[model samples]
Target: MKDKILIAGGYGNVGQVICSYLAEKFPGKIIAAGRNYEKADNFSKTTGGAVLPMKLDVAENHENSSLLDEVLLVVMCLDQKDTRFIEACIRRGIHYIDITASYKLLSDIEAMAGLAEQNGSTAVLSVGIAPGITNILVKHCKQRLGILEEAYINLLLGLGDEHGKAAIEWTVDNINTTFDVVENGNLQKVRSFEDGKESFFSEKLGKRMAYRFDFTDQHVLPRTLNIKTVSTRLCFDSVIFTRFFAILKKLGVLNLLKLKNFRRLFVKVFENFRLGSDIFAVAVDAIGEKEGKRAEYHCSIIGHKEGIITGKVAGLVAEKIYNGAYASGVFHIEQLFEPEEILKELEENIEIRCS
Candidate 1:
């Protein structure tokens, strides 16, 4: 029997893609587990039994030692507030991977590094677009320039793309919250979507307005990479919608989005309406000193759908971990994998450019 890989929330929008990708690669070793066993079972049938369906509610079964008996790795596609699930994985020596962008949750997971090392379990955090690819790009830039003084990550999401409920809720919840960021080597507080700047990408993406947001990359990069300053901003493909959110943030009315009813309404609207191209792009700019002279490097990747790209990244990382590429410890994606290597593997799904 092959080692089984469990994907929590395996029936979700992003998880579906992950299941298909890994099932094709590993064949009969994938288990799709979620709160809804019916949906998981139905979805498994679509995979031609390549994926096995299992019932797993993290909140309830987290401490069940037998839950992960035959599972060698667990890919978390859902958002979890408590670290108990991660603790359980570490206790059972099951390697873990999460695609969450939440700083607080990631910080808690990081706190368990010693225990993971002791148990010979590895956990990879920051495994998605902003924190995953963005962090990797920063590492690429730093390698090119020798030393990085400042870094800026610009994210452009396609308003026309279909995003999951969890993704939408995460955006709505953070729309009004304020967070700290390092600017010019000084820490400062900035409200989400409050500060704005114009960024230029490829001709297809062109120039767009990006606003400051509390992304996990901004928090983890400076400390991990020893960079003096790192900032991350977001912008939608639709300028009108981007400006609308910015105005609401300035007026202190963005908090209304936190209302469950309003958030659901917005999610529905986003799902039903298609305002722009379904292509998302991420660009990174790094300013540093190389060869005793000031220099800059820019790198970017453009992909069709955000969710699919995110799933592909997570799947790639899981494959690496299962193949014994990573050491037993908690690590961010950038710390464990090389940017060029990952981009090469994902070339079929994304276009990468650097200058």
Candidate 2:
């Protein structure tokens, strides 16, 4: 019977956390799958038999792979260059959830909605913190306002928190890049680490300047929420550290990340450096109309250990999809579930305030 949960890249940093959380509730039914069998097996042993290990690589062709024959759901913790494996999963009518923040990859998956529906499969995208919770928060703001004209998403990630190597690489690679964002109902090109905006995170973390960054939530929200303007900015918990990168960007020093060696070294530095508290924050500011008058709404969440929280969110969504029946097609987290439904599940682990 197809009753097992398969977590691709299940032995990695964030993947391990997801495996452990789901293993608690669905013991002996979670499979930690990856290309490295030894690593997968070792991590599984740490779960005390709750999480089983499987040798599975998602990059290869899945046309004849029977590894997923008994799997009912897949929680993707890794990023893929293409959607072939995802298509294979949907064709088999397996439920899928992805925590990736890649807009292009997500768009490809979304294009498969018709196929997914035809095969009776359900897929959830944008299942991580920024795109996951931030997307929902923006939706919350939209609900309060008569019409949401513009929305800004501020993300503060703690440098001291251990981030996965892939995440670190993505950050380092994008520091000197340019991406497009919707501005006034038009696509505008913007460079990363520029156009800094100050956001009030909390009492302990005061106001910090966050610069424009290509978080997928900003791209997904304009369409899903029908908002004209949406932007996502990123900063570290340490103010000095955040400024230092801005300076580097201003001087074109961050462009060195284009070199393979320099990029690897930069990733290494981030991996070894612990410069701030392990506290993460998300604040959303919305501008629109209420009762035909201009209005503003604000909401924020402060938490610790972002990677673990990401796993928890993914696990929560996975549990919902596994046990319940939803429309058989691709949908973003906000499109399928309400903001309150997600925030309530996280109230205990986070401090949430709205205005």
Go through the candidates in order and give each one's C-alpha lDDT.
Answer: 0.89, 0.92
Total colliding residue pairs, candidate 1: 0
Clashing pairs in 2: none
Model 2 alpha-carbon drift over 4 Å, by segment? none
Q: What is the overall TM-score of model 1 with all chains considered together? A: 0.96
- Global CA lDDT computed for model 1: 0.89
lDDT of 2 by residue, 1-355 (tens): 9999999999998899889989988999999999999999999888888999999989999976899999999999988999999999999999999999788899999999999999999999999898899998999999999799999999999999999898988788778778999999999999998999998877777888999998999999999999999999999988888999899999989888889998889889889988787899999989999999999999889999999899999999998999899999999999999988889999889998889
Predict model 2's lDDT versus the native: 0.92
Give, for candidate 1, the lowest lDDT window spanning 10 residues: 60-69
RMSD of each: 1.4, 1.0
